[model samples]
Target: MSPVRRGEKLPIYNRIGVLRAERKMTRAELAETVGINVQSVGALERGDNYPSLDLAFRICAVFDLPVEAVFSRTEFGAMSAELYRRPDLRPEPQSDPGGAR
Candidate 1:
């Protein structure tokens, strides 16, 4: 294994595993759909290998999503967090609640 690089441009994170789970699709299934092998699918999902532009586009097409929706340069937050963001997590308004400012 190679050392993990930080603050660099090479790292790429993806939501392939999450999307596959949502659709109940197996690695082999995805591999077949994308014209790759099972091991390559695993590699992509594990972030051990990066996909080429064509492969990335193919994967996005498989999920009916855009490239950014499937891949990111930074780490992704929890799927649920993105799906159901809490109102309380938002920045509070600066106005006085009691109206006595």
Candidate 2:
């Protein structure tokens, strides 16, 4: 394997941590479910290592999510922020309800 440069960006990013938290799953639990070591799970979550195709499929199966939802080449932002961002539907500023100017 080639050494990663200090400032090099990862080729792929994942939502494993977010998905695990959403499901209240631990690294150990996810590791066991995916037939991998807990350390490997940590590495994957940190983007220190990429999973093989089979391993990726296993992880997706455990989460019951499509691979695209779990992994992406682009960075994934917070779902709440993304959902609330609406340049086309901005809310009008409200005036003070009190009579004071």
What are the lDDT figures for the candidates, one per model? 0.93, 0.91
- In candidate 1, which residue ranges exceed 4 Å CA deviation? 1-9, 88-101
lDDT of 2 at 51: 96
Give every collision pair in model 2.
Answer: none
lDDT per residue as tens, model 2, 1-101? 56887878768789999989999999999999989999999999999999998999999999898998889989998967876986877689888889666
List CA RMSD, all candidates. 5.7, 7.9
> Compared with the true structure, what per-residue lDDT tens digits does model 1 show for residues 1-101?
55666655578999999999999999999999999999999999999999999999999999999999899999999988888987777777799878994
Number of clashing residue pairs, candidate 2: 0
Best by lDDT: 1
Model 1 misses residue 59 by how many Å?
A: 0.5
